[model samples]
Target: MIAARILDPDSKLATTRWWSTTTLPDILGVNDADEDDLYDAMDWLLQRQSHIEKKLAARHLTEGGMALYDLSSSYFEGTTCPLAALGHNRDGKKGKLQVNYGLLTDDRGRPVSVSVFKGNTGDPKTLMPQVRKVKDDFGIKTVVLVGDRGMISQKQIDEIKGVDGLDWITALKTDAIRKLADDQGPLQLGLFDERNLFEFTHPDFPGERLVACRNPELRKLRAYKRKSLLEATSLELTKVRAMVGRGKLAGKDKIGVRVGKVIDKYKVAKHFVLNIKDHHFDFHIDTEKVAAEAALDGIYVLRTSLAEERISTEDIVRNYKNLSQVERAFRSMKTMDLKVRPIHHRLENRVRAHIFLCMLAYYVEWHMREAWRPVLFCDEDQARKKTRDPVAPATRSKTALEKVHSKTLADGSTVHSFQTLLKQLSTIVRNRCRVPTDGPNAPIFDVVTTPTVEQQRAYGLLETIEV
Candidate 1:
């Protein structure tokens, strides 16, 4: 089933029967497992997830290696599963019941372990369990837990400090960054023009070092986004103001509600000050507030327990940015490549089993992506270029590579994405041909479809030999 998931990601278990009997039996050299077998196997695997995850960590993770952690949610269609509940839906299905799950990955973004929690679990609360799992179950000593700011609160930080040989790397929230800037005086943009990173310490967060980073490109993008939203919001607000002046909107509450809709639509409510009274409504752009925010537009602060002498600022930024790797994994698990939802499982254990199966499938897909990079649009090499600091975010490189790879090939042929390539592989079929009543035996044997040149090339890239 895991292999079926990787080979045909869009397929469900019932659809695997034909592929398994026709093709997989020849490749894997076994009788086709039925849907029930797959479900039972999933249940068995879920029961041993703890042991399996430990073995995975022992095999791939090293002591003191950085563990990147993050949380994602998937919606459930039915309400039968005990684990499904209303919560913060990362999948954007706000009214749907969902389950929150956290994934732990190694420094290179190989997933080591995953845990399912109730749908409403807060991101910060998910950290300690994962940290303990890394320390106690995986037996990884001197580990650095890297996550986004939402994963680590001040209380979580204090809890992490109590753990021996356990360190953390996470970014500060916008509020914390503002307070840091306030305490240190206004952050001079000229300093960032010379160098993008600066190190500082504050009494509020003792024993932790802060790395301030500025990206000029991010600054320009943020400024542009803010200006565009402000203009659009102003237009909407102006219409409301006209309505109020013309006496179309009489009550203060009605005018406030109209203004609120515009503010919410643009999501620039904080940048404007709105005043509403009986038969009067007006809004003024908060220039001072906007300026303050603009000053920190491209700036971000990373907080880590690693000592300054032990790690370079560039390395800190690079490691912190690897959180994007886990995020990428989540994207792969969700709608991007592997659609792990509209989950059909209604039992609690079955839900867990389904998620665990997807994780295992992704474990294989991750390696396949690396092996098949020559034929795919992957930037693993470009991302590791040593000519300059790789500390900058890799999002741009990934997007550029996606565009480059999706274009026509050098031979004027269409390029195949990873998913499309898999679809091509699925075309290779095994046929059961019956010999015409030879003697009395009436023997039958299976014949595999001859591989196309493109399929052969894909198999060669993946180092998979056709049976």
Candidate 2:
């Protein structure tokens, strides 16, 4: 059986409390394992997971709603972790310990489910499964999957639409995105404006829709960036195109000697952003010449199938940007760095258990982030300058966050209920009170005092965790 235990050093039952100390006294008892170690504890957890898995229903809501989305990964230093053989390490740390995970969440950033893959998993490849998992497992009846362009593909879009209740909003590359700008045809100047809605809907997926959303602010920003990019691309194309046949400038950098091919390839691609005003068939270029290069930048297209009955475009677009909330959850997972590399365990069971802990830890971390979000990244200094009050903004800010409601898990205590109890528990610290003859180490007395408001809140959250 795999071993497991409560490994947190600060916990009351910690036998290896000193293990986290970076400079250890010596390498003693390094390889020891007992019945009460992590592996055994893992067995119990797996049983719990299996029990949870059994409860997952088949043919669950493959159709529906609020599919929050993002990806995460871990790296490995050794070849032991099967998911570690690198491919598209998003973190750019491929040569180290790596594993990647993609997840879907609800409006509150509560994960619906997760899928793990090798660290090299491409972000685009992750889209379909993430959408499907929540649809199938969580009884999600109304799906509104939102992601950045890296997760968009026509095939992936088609897959989501293939399901009845799903919708999405994904960013598209600017060049490819330009198709939606003026409805691609003779629009009388007054036709598209503030109260008017322009829609392009597909017959096969009738609910599939694209609406152009460009505020003056968004447009001005895009215009400025596009001009800068076109200028830069032209300069690069000029320098590269200038180097003709077998010349030192060309061969000095090991450039392939296809003088005709390089210039021809380069000239056509630059036209996506640098097109003369009358270039008519530019939409076709997206499928052909400009696809790959356009993707190199983050220009994204938003596509959604959510029926207009449920939500409007502005809210959909705004909520979709909140997908970054899921992205941040994944970022925090990697940062805890619980030495989650090498993944030395070879048994499939251990790997599953190990991942489960990371998942559990992910829940806790996400929960905490939601709790402090109102104040964490907020600039208290500027906020104070604005003469603004902070309390009401917690509920009012566009930021949406909530932890999965939990009573005591295992023992089943409600979080609020236990929070009250833990505030009563006290911690004792040693302090030196020297009278002339005392030894170098002074023994401290138990200091039972009132809990600070913050400490009471902290302990209250922990009290909900059943042993």
Candidate 3:
């Protein structure tokens, strides 16, 4: 199954059967296994998933290590499975039944465990079960839990604080930030001009430190986005107003619904004040509200239980930002790479088994990418350089252009991406030859293909020899 994920990520069960019979046997040096074998193996793994997760945690996690948690949803086709229901669809598949799953990863972005939950499960509710698993199932002590704002609640924080030797690192929500910035708040625009970060404490959040960070480039980007959205909203409002002036629209309820849509379309309803009377409709932008929101354009607050002396503010920001690693893992499991979607399994266990298989496949791919960095395009080395401009997001070339297709290694040999290198290695094939029959059950001879130097070097990085 791992090999199928690496070689044919977008494959379904039928395609996997073909691969096992044809391509996989040559590479793995084993007899062809049927689709039943695959299905049985998945069921067996699902039955022992808990034990497997504990073993993984024992091998990869340690005391004081960071455990990052996040949730993602995938849509299902039918309603036969009990896990499938209408809920928050992260995949943008509205009106479709979906299943939600939580993924827990180590600080290095390697997946440690995953849990399947009902589609209607809330993000904050998923954290406690994972917390229990980390403490009770994995038997890990003194580990910090890292998550986004959606995954951590005030109640959850209180619960985590009660646990001995467990800490949390999370960001504050927008409303919480606004409350912190009330009268004589610690966050001020001027403080950002002198330095990007400031440290403070809040009465409500006792025994915790807050780190406020500002990005000038992010401020400019937000300002531009706000202006564009406001303009679009204004244009929409003008159209509605003209309709009212021309006597095309009437009735208070009708105008209210129409104006509501205009404001909702651009998501700037809070910035606009709508007035509706009999046969009259008008709207105006609340400049004070707009300015107040603009003041917080680039500001973000990170709350943590760790003391300033234990971990620097910069390191705190870096660790919080690493939540993007979990996001990247989701992207890989979704459309970005692994395409673990459009689930057709009807049984609940089968659905869970399918997602589990995808997670396991991703685990193998994660290690493979790290081991084959010399022949693959790794983003870690270039991440710092890419973040030099805070406003612009980093981008990599989707298609290799002729000018920058290959990279030159220290030995002066050209290397390609892992996918491209795999394609190069696929040229080596095994041939079967018939030898003269010495006895009744004579063994047949097999001739192995000679691997090119490039294939040899690529395999060498993985600490394996070409077959």
Candidate 4:
């Protein structure tokens, strides 16, 4: 099941047909197994999920270490699964039912465990159970949890505060950060002039450290995006105004409805002011609001319970930004690498099992990526990631850029993406042969194709890792 997901992801029925053409049937000793057998195996896998997750947690996690947690929802294809419910659709599949699942990973973003929740479950509501699982199931005590602002809101942080030996690192929400930059707030814009990062404290958050960072590049990008959105919204509003002027669109209700669509489409309603009267409509950019928003463009505040003596400000920001790793995992699972969406399972447990299987498959892929970095397009100089300025946007190493431009490794081997590398490996085949002079009952022999130099290099690299 895992091999099918890793090599060529598909539904159980499709997987059965696909794997039959490979050597997996003979190698894994499931030559006669059908789709039913695979489903039964999923059932069996679900029963042992806790045991498997516990083993994973033991391997990657440690006491007083940091763990990253995040939740994402995938759209469901069928209506029968009870876990599927209508709620926030991250997959952009409007009106579709989805199931939310929380992923817990080590500080480096190696997936440790996954828990499924109803689609309607809020992000903050999923935090407590994972905290309990890490502490109770995984036996990791005194751990620092890292989550995004949405996941570790004030209410969730309040709950986590009561738990002994539990701490967290998360950014302040936009509103919270805005309040910090208010006239009377402790945060100062001048602090960032000398350096992109600075630390400060406020009475509102006692005994917790706040790390403020401003990325010039991020600030400029946000400014550009906001300008584009404002212009687009204005253009649409101008069309509506023109319609109202030409008598093509009249009535206050009609004009208001048309204006609302433009505002919602661009989502820049806050930066615009509108006036709609009978057969008249006019709108203007709210410059004050736009300037206020742009002032905090590249700025963000990270809040953490750990003291400076425990973890540095740079490390805190880097750890919070590592949530991108979890996002990458979700992209791979939902899109192509695993095909975890469009779930065919009607039973709730079956759906859970399917997601768990994909998580396990990703766990293997993560290790493969780390081991195959020498030959892949991935950057090999990971040590710099920890030492570089966390506030600045990440840049690829010089060696990595050369590999991308040259399309080959230092030894003249070609570079490959993870998917294309797998395709290259699939060319090796095992053949059955018999002597022509022998009788019909003659013994058959197996001959496996010799791997190419590059394929052999890949195999040799993977041999050193124990995924």
Q: What would the per-residue lDDT of candidate 4 be over residues 1-467, giving only the tens digit for each residue? A: 99889998988999989976899899989999999999999999999999999999999988889889999999988898999999888989999999999999887779989999999999999999999999898888789999999999999988889888898999999998999998978887888889999888888899899999999999999999999998889888999999999999988888888899899999889899899998889989999999999999999999999988999989999989988889888888888698888888899999999999999999988888888999999899989989999999999999999999999998898999999999999999999998677578887899999999999999998888875
Best by TM-score: 4
Clashing residue pairs found in predicted model 1: none
lDDT for 123 in candidate 4 is 97
Ranking by lDDT: 4, 1, 3, 2
lDDT of 4: 0.92
Best by lDDT: 4
For residues 283-374, what per-residue lDDT tens digits would candidate 3 score against the true structure? 88999999988889888899999877777767677777778888988888877556678888888898898888889888887777777765
Score residue 33 of candidate 1 by CA lDDT. 61
Descending-TM-score candidate ranking = 4, 1, 3, 2
* Candidate 2 residue-wise lDDT, 1-467, digit = tens: 11111122122123344443312213344445343575677777777863443233222123444566777666554667666666665566736756766766666565535667766778888887665555555556666677776777666776665676666777656655544333553222233345232445544335566654433444456556755655554555455444432233434223333323433544444444321121111111233333344322222335676668876665655566667667666654454322333355555566666666655655554554445332233221323322322111222222212212322222332333222332233242223344455786665543335665655556565555533
Estimate every model's Cα lDDT from 0 to 1.
Answer: 0.81, 0.49, 0.80, 0.92
Off by over 4 Å in 1: 10-13, 16-22, 25-32, 183-186, 380-387, 391-415, 435-443, 464-467
Per-candidate TM equals 0.90, 0.59, 0.88, 0.98
lDDT (tens digit, per residue) of candidate 1 on 121-168: 899999999988988998888888899989987889988898998988
Worst 10 residues of 4 by lDDT: 435-444
Which is the winner by TM-score between candidate 2 and candidate 3?
Answer: 3
Identify the superior model by TM-score, candidate 2 or candidate 4: 4
Worst 10 residues of 3 by lDDT: 394-403
